[model samples]
Target: MNRTWKNRGIVFTLALLFVTVEGFAQGNNNPPPKSPEVHGDQRVTFRIQAPNADSVKLSSSDIPGSMFSRHMAKNKEGVWELTSDVLAPGAYRYRFEVNGISVIDPRNTSFSESNENIWSLVTVPGNPMMDTRDVPHGAVAEVTYHSESLDRFRRMHVYTPPGYESGEGQYPVFYLLHGAYDSDDAWSTVGRAGFILDNLIAEGKAKPMIVVMPDGHTGPFGYGDELPMDEFIQDFKNDIKPYVESHYRVKANRENRAMAGLSMGGAHTLGIAIPNLDEYAYIGVFSSGVFGLVNNDGSVVEASETAYVKQNSEVLSNDDLKEGLELFWFATGKEDFLLDITRATVTMFEDYDFDVVYEETEGAHTWLVWRDYLIEFTPKLFK
Candidate 1:
């Protein structure tokens, strides 16, 4: 912490930046490309300089593609360029893989949106984007711990309910998940989850519950299925759940437990909840795309919309599901692309003779919708 070391660190950082930029500019005729510019249409033109890299590709869960890859073409001088189509307004996490190493744009000084980890942000001009909302929010704590499964310390965020430390009885628990482009802190921070929970709890609208948000993004190939789904399941069933149960005085039962999330996390909630019918009693899906949409191969028949309807129709015709397993909830913003999928899910569940509460609001796939969904969904838990 001495002046000498601090000076050295600054010098080292500058040196690294110089080398990184120079390395890319060496053989290129063009100057380093400018930082991405977001337009009114939500299109983002991303430019990165990497002259030495043989190839570069943009990796993100927000962008739709079979490979989740957006290849950047290098100019004669080695600067790379690629532009994204009009994206939905929300927080989209991405990185530049210069050959292999994940990197943030050095030129863009937007600062890290994800705390402790560095990822850049492009704020789309709009009212409901995650970055634009103004609300009295809650604190976001990113605590790290050693995990036996990952063989290293991992991190998770715990959004303590508004009156968390103050009262008497143990509260219920809600395990929330984030979409593909988000991490544990995405909801509590960007999505205003903590603030929404705080307001609801203060108003005596929501049952007091411990909200546990964990990082759903594991990137072996950026947002690909190379991740260990079974390990994730085990971590939830064994590590996360047990850790929370032991640390916090949360009621441990299906009636007191709920699970929900946005997009990918919504799908994850369903995937985890349906199998563990005895564990989670309430389940919510907010603009869920991964599990609610088509399968990995892009086949229409494998879509959740189709599957839900088919299953529910069969169940209804046979008088199946006389005993409901869980409380099903679905919500999606009107402007969100995932609306179709959510609507289909509701119809399917209804057809199967299950009561599913559905909420369609005015917003897009951004944090605005997710936060709104949480505000409505949280009160329904443990009631």
Candidate 2:
């Protein structure tokens, strides 16, 4: 926090800028290539500086075709380049495999979290729902708050709708959660929660509301391990909700609040919102359901499956819990890995006589589908 270090930080930044500019100043050279150039035709050309490697290939989820990995042509200057077929208008994450070692695009500053790994972001704007149109925008702020349940500091992104800063009216709060492997930044970034809400508000399709994207990741665990879901739920109930309600001009009633999440976040939403139905009137589950109860082969685990059936049976059977419920919506892609999970969840709610609206759409479990789910779900909230 000292001025000396602050000045040194500025100097370091300027040095980096100067070095990059100085490289271009050396005329007729392209060693440091400008990468991820989006063309008007929707084709994206990517260039990377990896001269020493034997082969450099592009690896991306958005890249068309099998493997999503293609070798790039190397030039005399050792810069590797590749141009892809026209891509859809949406956000895409990509990284390069330089001689088998995966690496991000050094030239791109826009990037996002992908589970345990990181990837660079590229946006090809065309869709009205996903495009950054000339509409009044909202503010996405990174907020830090202390969690008493976990005894640690946590971070979340809060999106205030347009005119919220100057308006005096208290806005209803929508608690949006991100899935496993993603940080608190996912919703605000690749999920495009803020922009989606902005466009919806601009079109008068959705009411202006405060979106609270909390960190759902609780512990350090990899795939196939049991995530600390209860910890996250407790943190949400004790820390995240209180922080937002106290800091922002939020409506304090149960009807003015909503909760939704995708994948692991959907699991969290079910865990938090259902048992505490008096708090969240609107609930949405996207591409996820009760996990750990059944194995991948469809066999139920006696320990988890039997226990959960008895655990929330009371709340599930109680008709009084649904009195103030506005909506219980669920959406999942037919090809999503969690499609079965979602189906089971919908079946369970239906069996319990809970009025559930389920929609099966096309696509898999990805940010694109989640964004679409948000667009469809938000308009139905806080009504």
Candidate 3:
């Protein structure tokens, strides 16, 4: 009788569990359909439950442009789905366009700040350089400093390499700037600056260093015709440099300093670093050259409104200053829209008898190229 009762009890418990699971499955606790499902073959299928929407489209930074927008087909269940072509292994920023209205994927929790806007971030996870691994990891701290130049408190993301908290030595500093439409935080996140550095440092490919990512955009909003060049340079000189030197264990000299940027930030790198060439040992410009300096017709070269090229003529012609510059590197994608400007700028440097290492690589103006450039660039620094 006891055995029979025990058996009955076990059956009862399972029955109760079945009812509970059935209720839970049918209840509001059931999560919505997961979108952006990455498959083993590298293609990604996106899904959205838009019962009322007539049409849907998927657009991404990885998708080239609007010409490649993927159509999402709706089903009987009011759900829409689209599977993308096989993608390269990297992170991508994507969004859903429902009947011409732009919207982020409601299911995705991660987002990245881009050239002009924000997009949901998704990764396929194959590249080890940008992927998180078990290593002596560094920390990226969102730093707030008083920018007396801007008359407001500005923010920056500073990365201190592994063992920095306990180490007693000063490390070389690299000031990495972001392009337009992005702020300081964009480097650490969308650009994957911290992770790439971490991997390089761990692999013994790069020296452990403190990377200072500062805000290139100083305006109240987005980039306007005001050209944040002047004020940003002022902030870096008067506020950023002083604050960083005082607070961090930085090797405060020209030999220990480096600066590099992409696109608009590349223009910034040119404007700021070239004028003050004595202060930086290494400079890298990616996917950009001087913006206002060049024109479509390639006729006149005013050179960035301040007559920058003419004003800095002394430094441009000084061979001693060129000797001090360890690396004046420029890289642009072959298909990059700014390819002409990059080549012209390199030619400009060479014309001044300045040494320049220019690398024209495959691909276009995308974050993947920038990250790849960083992976290859940082390994050459501080040696």
Candidate 4:
């Protein structure tokens, strides 16, 4: 009787152990492991549990040394994983292509939508310039106003510095602009201009000021058509400026007003701000494909005796105009496709003997370079 009872107990214990092991195996097959594990040195590891997938590829945007499509290795547990090299500090968008179909990271919820493509977003921390530190953040408001130029109610994003509401002092204004095919929120969302300014102000690196980002697109037009530069300039000057100055406690004068932009908006800055030097004390042209100076083939168009060039030359030649100008800044990436044009523009400024601050850094025509430009440019403004 005792031997039979001991045999039964042994059988029961073995059965319980088997059930636990089976449950663990089922759980392992149920869901994938944590993905996008950002490490201390900025290296990121991505994982996905695709037991039946034939192939997996990882695609990313703006990650240095990243391949167009990196093959992921699958483990015995059917878990596919790939570790990326140490990346710079910035927000990056990525996606996994499982058997030719793109999908977002199931484990990561952060995402960004551009056109129709949705990409998983990951931000490697440690960039103080772009990071949102424990500081007094400014208020970003979506303002809607009737555009007399477009004959519609357009929206803009305005960033009022911390203490702006309580402070009685009028602050200087920076008329920030976005590239083509982007809305006014581009500066706040993608460019992160608000956080950049917050950290700069908190650390005493930049003066507390208001930033106005306006949409550059005017009228119902598709891509490839010439942007209505004249309409945009007039609306900015006649309509947007008045609305901003009236709504916010801003110093509405040339000495306190500054304008800067990137890409197509940079071209607009060069066209609008440089010619209207008396209206803007500070002008920043970043990665601007200077209209006549840059050709369609990315070659430098020689300084011609065209009316446009001649007009800019005349405006920059005046000592009084140059002296009145607080800051005439131009910056571009060394590897930018528009580098030749930027260099030519600088040469034209030099030829005119204008006091221009030209900056060149190692990067392509991307938001990473533009963020750096904003950090360096803001400190030099309204000083």
Candidate 5:
């Protein structure tokens, strides 16, 4: 009986050893998946194993111009791979489409979402302007405040620069605004604003200040629809500005306050900040301008060269407007669709002797240009 039991034990141990060896061999045969691989030259290669998929395509946020989609090729291993051209160093959003259905990269964990879409994110390092450097980083906090105008609790992302916790002095504030179809999180997530500011402040290129990104949408309007400008501006004044000033360590003065925005937010800056110049000393309008005026009766009045000048005549003609403002900077990409309107607005400002620093770079109205605008604009603040 002892001999029989010992034989059974040996058989069980041998069977366990054989199963372990087989599992190890199988694991070695199948390598781990690597979806996004950033190359040395800033090009990125994305791969996905979709054996059952009939078709696969790539959609990346870094695509220049109007083309946002690219066709990907599938290999014999049922892996779809596509290498992007040399891209700029920044964070980008991308995803895959399998048989006409959008899907996130299964291997990538980082992602960002707008009101309409969810996209996988990839950070291409090596650019210090946008990259996270070995510097003292700031603290970002999401704070909620009650909005009297909107009659709801709105949230904002605030970035306090390095040494803010131990520092004693109140810093200047930059009320940064996001574009349409985006939330308050857009600046830090896709824009990389916090990292950009960190690098700038470390290098002494930008002043250590607080950046407040507020939700520009005041009403329940879908993407591409005109926002409630009056309500948004009122809320910013009545709710957001007061809340930020009372909560954060910020200088509550016009000289220390600045306002800037991109796209629809830029339009809001024009409509809100220009009239309230006493509130914001520095104003930046990027890739957008006053397309039209919102009447009290909620009517849309198309902006004309004459009408623009006529409506803002007092503000444009006032010598104090230019003298009081620290900077009135506007920039737009040369290929941006709104370049003509930006040019018209710049012309209007120049015609009235308003000291507006206008810039035109080589790109369209995308986050790339907006990020560049933030990097350039932040350095000029509180100087």
Candidate 6:
């Protein structure tokens, strides 16, 4: 009798578990899709509730604007819904386009990134692409002053190399630029530039130097038809250089100073730094368009992009640059939309009897690739 009772109890427990599982499954026919959870201060999400609209498009930096077709069953109150997987954390600017007009997220109260007034801001946790491993991180200080040139308040972010104040030696400086629709924080905040430089300086790969990140999108100086080429030069000479010399203990000379940038920033650096050979000895351009091949007059000298590259192929021929300027480095991912442009720019440099360091990696136009480029490029500068 005791053995029979034990057997009955075991069977009854098993039956209860089976019923419970079946009931749970039946209750949830289609499981709810999980939203992105925070991962080590990383991950990002964008949501909009447009119940009446037929289609809504969401656009953000780096990622293309994606379209979402709303479904009544998936979204509450018959609203449109869309979500992104875990995204590398940092400040992101995005906008929603209902039909054709651009609008900020009605639900989100975050501030807009710029005055042009299209996209709003979203801050994520980790900036993995621009991660600086706590070697010797620097603080970001905003210095504001009246500018006689612009006749307005001018601000610049000055990055003092590790132990700048305690150390007696003056350091070299690199003026890093940001692309269009970006600001000075793009380097320190999102790019993790201070972290990268600190690590490089600690490892003895890069010489300790003050890095100046200036706002590159300042409109024409002194008004009256500002040329991109001329404005590019004026920014370095008038705005950026004077500020560094006055405030920081920087080596205000040509050999120790360097200039580099990406995309629009790259174009700005090349245009400004190349011809003014006396100002910057080391120069780098990452995934910049072939705007340099054109003349100062803004006219295309080379008949075709193909011919232009062929003409300047020697300077940017290989990963190991031949060296004409103190250091000429340019890199781009194979999948980058501007790969052809980088290749062409390299070719143009080579054809023009200039030597350049050219390299290609794997990725599209993104911060991930740009971050790695910093790692690789940092070691080469001031070497």
Measured over all alpha carbons after superposition, the RMSD of each candidate to the real structure, in angstroms, is 8.1, 4.3, 11.0, 12.7, 11.4, 15.9
Model 2 clashes, total count: 0
Worst 10 residues of 4 by lDDT: 11-20
- Candidate 1 root-mean-square deviation in Å: 8.1
Ranking by lDDT: 2, 3, 5, 4, 1, 6
Q: Which 10 consecutive residues of model 6 have the lowest summed lDDT? A: 65-74
Q: Can you write out model 1's per-residue Cα lDDT over 126-171, one digit (the tens) per residue? A: 4332343343344557766556765666667887755456656787
lDDT tens per residue, model 2, 1-383: 54323643553344345335444554426546787999999989998765555888889865565146999998776678999888877787887877787777778878776554566788888878778989999999988899999998877899999999888999999999888867777887778788889899999999999999988877675878886688998998899888998999999889999999998889899889887878889999998887755578976454325555577778788898887889999999998888877777777778788899999999888776888899999999987
lDDT for 67 (candidate 2): 49
lDDT of each: 0.66, 0.81, 0.80, 0.78, 0.79, 0.61
- CA lDDT of 329 in candidate 6? 89
Model 2 residue 253 CA deviation in Å: 1.6
Clashes of each: 3, 0, 0, 0, 0, 12
Among residues 3 or more apart in sequence or in different chains, the pairs in candidate 5 whose N, CA or C atoms overlap within 3 Å are: none
Give TM per candidate.
Answer: 0.61, 0.89, 0.87, 0.80, 0.85, 0.67
**Candidates 2 and 3 compared by TM-score, better number:** 2
What does the lDDT read for residue 231 in candidate 5? 82
lDDT by residue (50-92, candidate 4, tens digit) is 6566888888755655538789998887767998898778777
Number of the candidate with higher lDDT, 1 or 3: 3
**What is the overall TM-score of model 5 with all chains considered together?**
0.85
lDDT tens per residue, model 6, 1-383: 34323543453344334323433544534332222223443545455444444555666654433323221222544333455555654445565655554555544444333312334455555543344465776555655655555656666677887677777788788888776655565766556677777777777777877888776656623334332445545756776688778878878887788888887789778667755665677888877756545555554456244433454344334433334368888999898777766776777666665667888888777665776777787777776
lDDT digits (tens) for residues 265-380 of candidate 5: 89878877777777789999999876644344544444443455566667777887678898999999999877877877777677678788999998997888898999999999
Q: Report the number of backbone clashes for model 1.
A: 3
Report the lDDT tens digits of candidate 3 across residue range 63-146.
554335778897765667988778777777787777776666766777775543566777776788888889889999988899
Off by over 4 Å in 5: 1-32, 219-224, 293-313
lDDT of 3: 0.80
